[model samples]
Target: MDPLYLGAIVAIATILVLFSGVSVGLGLLIVSGGFLVIFDGMRSLELMPEILFGKLDNFALLSIPMFIIMGSSISSTRAGADLYEALERWLTRIPGGLVISNLGACALFAAMSGSSPATCAAIGKMGIPEMRKRGYPDGVAAGSIAAGGTLGILIPPSVTMIVYGIATETSIGRLFLAGVIPGLLLVGLFMAWSLYATWKSGDPNLLNGRSYTWRERFEVLPRVLPFLAIILGVLYAMYGGIATPSETAAVGALLCLIIAVVIYKLWHPRDLWVVLRDSTRESVMILFIIAAAGVFSYMLSSLYITQSIAEWIGTLEVNRWVLMGAVNVFLLIAGFFLPPVAVILMAAPILLPIIITAGFDPIWFAVILTINMEIGLISPPVGLNLYVISGIAPDISLKTILLGSLPYVACMVLAIVLLCLFPGLATWLPDAVMGARL
Candidate 1:
């Protein structure tokens, strides 16, 4: 069979398998391995160890676990709770303050945790309940944080960006820098939606925010500032050429542990055990997907399917914007079914070459792709953040969470359009700070 037709069939099969409730990593491995054996016999299967295991041997990949630990350890503490309190204290005077406050805390917590579900679980546990207490509607209260949680992958020190960097051989530092402006842009868009929602409802409770003393506001800072500083330190170390991402991740992870122990008194063996256990589980899951993706990519490359597809796309005479739209639609569909990390690992290799060939900046596209993933986090089927929100606030039906999150989904879609109009939103900082890629 021609590689093109076979590739299309394989793609359809992969999606079907995923929808059947198989674990993503395992599903990829099974489908890829089976197809490879059938494609070229058992001899081809022997190379799996060299192709897959060798991919796992990357040194930069070490940063993944460290970053996971940074998020996990901090999450085990009262940090998310305190971060929400800090933002809540200040934003409470405004209409829809609770909603805005949750989004603000989510952005900050995303910086610290770099995991979407973790951000949602940590913040929603506290923020959602409070928003309900303030008489905020279900959709606005649960939906806001559910959408906000998607920030984890776009913020600095994001594991998803790191995965993309490693897969494409792009600079990790540049990817991190690339995400900063766009991440903030998404935050702004989310808040604007919150404010607009507040206005639309004309609910007095949204306006009647509780006042906080300056002392209460100042005190929450001590607990939250350290995590913020850790994020800044990681960004600077990587951008300023002071430390490698792995080294930065290592230091950030250590600081998170120290703060969790000293400030939050997370020193008990049971607490530490839970942190390690959860981090390990999440990290292993991500790494397994990456390894599976490596094998899948290898299958395509070995058979020339990926190159053939890219060449076909590149040869098309269609306008570049139309091509980008097609690519974004495909990414959005993939994101709806898969977690961001899995999507990045599976798609980046094939897409990066085509993106460069089309004269698009890979880093800018990374931001656009992350925004698409943000939508997926709120969208149905595999919308992980929606489930996270539903788990935390069981009273809020899935339909309510999905409906509330729709506007934020529109906000993310608008973000992608904006980044398309002004690519600088994703590129300016990286080019200015590190100089543009040749």
Candidate 2:
């Protein structure tokens, strides 16, 4: 009969529904609605309409659809093929150069697209065949694409950052600014691991003893500069407060379209229609999740579960370091079973309050949490990246991709530990830029 007990049941039921193949939006709505009716009676039904409308009314949320359109459009237009070709020409001299190039291309594409699946699909299609033709091992090729793809969320213009900012009421612009350095750091780490792996494989012949001309190396730079320009333009506008997040997303989308149409001359009027339709579909799904998450988050608040959990964690005498380490472990475990978006939506509400109560910076926690999600992308069982790569290389078993990804996963874990030890890695830019404004 207790509200707390009933709330617990509803929460469990929600998890069951998700695991049993129900849509996340529908599961959250069903559970939240069930709790409202059982706990607050028929009078509670009146609140649903307003709650749903309020959740959808968020102006900042408009950025989601716009950015998705931009990413999908750029992706469909095959703009990244140019960047990959340029990178390949520059990196082709080294052993496992193509593999290393795959990582670089994915990182660049991620900065542009900000979606892991898109990054994986685009770069994988190009890189996998090249690497295979060049005698790279199947596992290595698959792992490289899968691991590199995760840079999408870690890099700027990231949908993950936007969603986290919306949930925690943090400045999305500041969060975007904060991710730039750390994302690049992870890319560097992955590059280092790829080089080391190549060296360890003992295939000096893989280098093909090839070298590029000075003129040729310099030539590719110009072709790749546009991708860099678009990313920097979006981030610069957001960081400078020259544009709001949604406005910047709109600008980025238009810029991507122009680049495809005018610069690349690859896009046509019909292509625009397809991009809009796909973006609308993806945006609607994300918005539905956001709306349902808002209702579920509201229900959690009404039940005092967040407050209770925060109070309990706050009362503990453990070191802050221990708490953070525990949070990383929790996130990794949760990622194995839940999708990254769901993991963030469900866990952030509960864990964030505890994090803030313990005097940790919310933005730093967001970065740390994002890294943990990256690990989940490569981890076995439910690693989405693994599946994405596997779909590309059906011959390579899921187990092999997971095994091959281990070193990159270690690199990510090390990156997280470094960031945890030196929170400045994550906080410095945000503070330097945002602090001056204040």
**Best model number under lDDT:** 1
Candidate 2 residue-wise lDDT, 1-438, digit = tens? 555465567668877988888888888888888877877787887888788779888789989887887788678766678778778878887666777788999998987887888888888888887777767776678878888999988788888888888888888887887787899898888888777776677787765535778887787676568767988888788878798989989988888777777766655778778878888888888888888888888888877777777777888899988988898898998887776777787777888988988888899889999998988888877888888888877877888888888888988999998897888998999889888333
* lDDT computed for candidate 1: 0.88
What's the lDDT for residue 198 in model 1? 72
Candidate 2 positional error at 145, Å? 1.1
Q: Candidate 1 — which residues are off by over 4 angstroms? A: none
lDDT of 2: 0.82
Output the worst ten-in-a-row residue range by lDDT, candidate 2.
1-10
| TM-score of every prediction relative to native | 0.97, 0.94
Looking at model 1, report the run of 10 residues with the lowest lDDT sum: 199-208
lDDT of 1 at 283: 88
